[model samples]
Target: MSESVVSGLTDLLQRMRQAQREQPHPDASLRRIRLDALAALLRENRPAICEAIDADFGGRPAEETDLLELFPSLQALAHARRHLRRWMKPKRHLAGLWFLPARTLLVPRPLGVVGIIVPWNYPLFLAVGPLVDALAAGNRALVKMSEYTPRFSALFGQLVERYFPQGEVRVVNGDAGVARAFSALPFDHLLFTGSTDVGRHVMRAAAANLTPVTLELGGKSPAIIGPGARFESAVERIVYGKCVNAGQTCIAPDYVLLPRGREADFIATAQRVVARMYPQLATGGQYASIIDDAKHARLIRLRDEAVAGGAQAHALAASSPADAGRVLPPTVLTDTPEDAAVMDEEIFGPLLPLVPYDTLDEALAYVAARPHPLALYLFDNDSAVQRRVEQSQAAGGMCINDTLYHVAQHHLPFGGVGASGLGAYHGEAGFRTFSKMLPVFRQARLNGVGLLNPPYGARFRRMLDLLLRR
Candidate 1:
């Protein structure tokens, strides 16, 4: 790491902190200005944004940029902009019995400067989601775009610079070495979106500075298909979520838990549905690549391991040799062992392994023993079964009949618990993550409660002890 590079970014932060103290509390007008600027930047720079992401991914689909990345970001910004003023208002809190005479209010205050670390998968949404939170909380922020997406990093930096002042918001770009330096900075709050292993490193780094962190980490999320589920609908929803972005989505169904006798039916339906969704396996412009060759190879290795372990593996759609540019077929593996490599790790690709259980209780037990997942999808029409699963299992979020769509609602708070990750941000949840609830107390000018101010007489002490005890 270059000393000069570290020094330059550090100095920028120091100046921003000083400015925050010197400036007055941002009024509603300044908050609106900040959010409006971001909205305009996102709307006007859509083309450059798409191009940069496409360049980074070796020709990512343009519609995906529009539909998945840009559209959701724009909607999030709009939602935040509409509610920013209300969210910034000071909230009134009730005083307890002992403090009934005094009035209390919680003033939401920004923590000066915030740091957001973006991930390679879904870079735009990940970056903008936290950015909206920081802005809505009335704080200046610095964004560190992922180095894996170099083109998006460079282009995002330029767009941010054009829309925001260097002191207000700046995008920093570098390799992993630079990322380490960035995480080490003492930001007031830091939000990271990435793999679970990297999340631990970020949390440890933030701990040194006593910085608050919100980690949106990914684990082996599961989708369970009960015996009573509508097979066709379940297949359609699962395939749609998993096949999107070549299954690079953090919330994509990692593997599945199916009833013992239903594995064959599920696999057969999945094959038909996936084929319908992606007519051309390799060259279809609607189909996305596996991000990079390394990810492609990793999925292949997992497939090989599962097959060698006696799991039934099938690549339903066969692709031509010439069209193999980081493309993996939508695959379904059945009867995988609990200890197999596919079950042990997060399958962040289009490989869906089916682990069959004789009973639903067994499936719940298996998921409970594993690390808490970011999301869980259960396909069952039985209310009793859904309630039992909800009460027994712990996850960041759960969808009743679908996969990954829980994160899309924008009305619910999204985050992981335990090892999946910590903290949450989306809609109002984002505003709260960035703002501190500073409680203020107001008291009457009368000195009615000053009996023991200076002289601690026996009478005063006795009264205090009796009152506290009672």
Candidate 2:
């Protein structure tokens, strides 16, 4: 880590901390103003933000960026703004008869300064979504953008500085070393979104300061095609979810579980769906390219390794020449070994693996054996099967007969489980995550509790007995 970068981040943290101390609680009007500023920032720079993301990714589709990043971000902001006052209000609690004239209230207070570390994938949504909660909860924040997406990072940083004061919300752009130093800073709370391996490092860094962390990490999220599922509908939705961002999404279905002897049928349906979705791979405007050559190559290698391990590889779209672009046509692998790299790691790309199972129990068992994923998809109309699978399996979130839509619902809490992630943030849950719920109890001068505070006496004994009986 560069000394200058560390010093700069430390200075920024000090400023925010000082500001938070000055105003520990921001009024609802001020919070709404900050949220409105964020909305305006997005509204005014919509085109520029899309272009910056497209430039960062060699050929990220503008429409995909809008649908996945911009839309969700604005939705989160709007939700927060609409409910800011209610969320900030102290919740009242009932006081017992014995404690008459006493009041109990739960107050939500800001956590001073918060640090948010965003990942490259869905950069805008991840950054903006968390910022909405942090700001709504009345905390000053510092965001660290991924170095991989240099164009978007720099553009976003400039926009934040232009729209908001540095003491309120600041954006920091740096490489891994800078990220390491940034994570080490003592903040009231830290939220990191990325892979599990790196989440460990972030947690370790935050540990020095004893900063509470909310890690939105990724894992091999699986999609199961129930035996009674509508095959065509399930395949279509899965294809759309997988290909939207070229399967780079953290909650994207990394693999599929199909009934025994149905692997071929599922693959054929996937191919047809992909073909219809992207008529042209080389120049199709709808299909997004991999973020860069390294990621593209990693996906290819995963497919190749699965093939070399005796798995059948099927390309959904026509193979474009390597020189054409960084687009790696969606490929499906079948009969992959359990120990294959693609199966072991969270395939954060377009490569999908199919695992056939003899029974639904087998499918559920397979999922249970691995680390809990961030999301799980089940395609079936049968309430019994849905209930069975939902109850038996453990994941951060679940969508029945759908994919990737759960995270978009502002009412739902989104995060991970075990290796997938820790702590959730969305809607009111997000506000709570960023805020501290302080319980306050006020006693009136005429309260009866004084009777029990003195030495052990007959009146105290009688009062205690009456309370215990109640």
Q: Could you say which candidate leads in TM-score?
A: 2
> lDDT of each structure?
0.84, 0.92
Error of 2 at 222 (Å): 0.9
In candidate 1 the C-alpha lDDT for residue 342 amounts to 84
Alpha-carbon runs more than 4 Å astray in model 1: 452-462
Instruction: Encode model 2's per-residue lDDT on 227-290: one tens digit a residue.
Output: 8999999999888888888899999999999888988888899889987889987687678888
Tens digits of lDDT, candidate 1, 2-40 = 999899889978988877777636876887788888888
Each model's TM-score?
0.95, 0.98
- Clashes per candidate, residues 3 or more apart or on different chains: 0, 0
Q: In model 2, which regions exceed 4 Å deviation? A: none
Judged by whole-model lDDT over C-alpha atoms, candidate 1 comes out at 0.84
**Model 1 steric clash pairs:** none
Q: What residue pairs clash in candidate 2, if any at all?
A: none
Model 2 / residue 111 / CA error / Å:
0.9
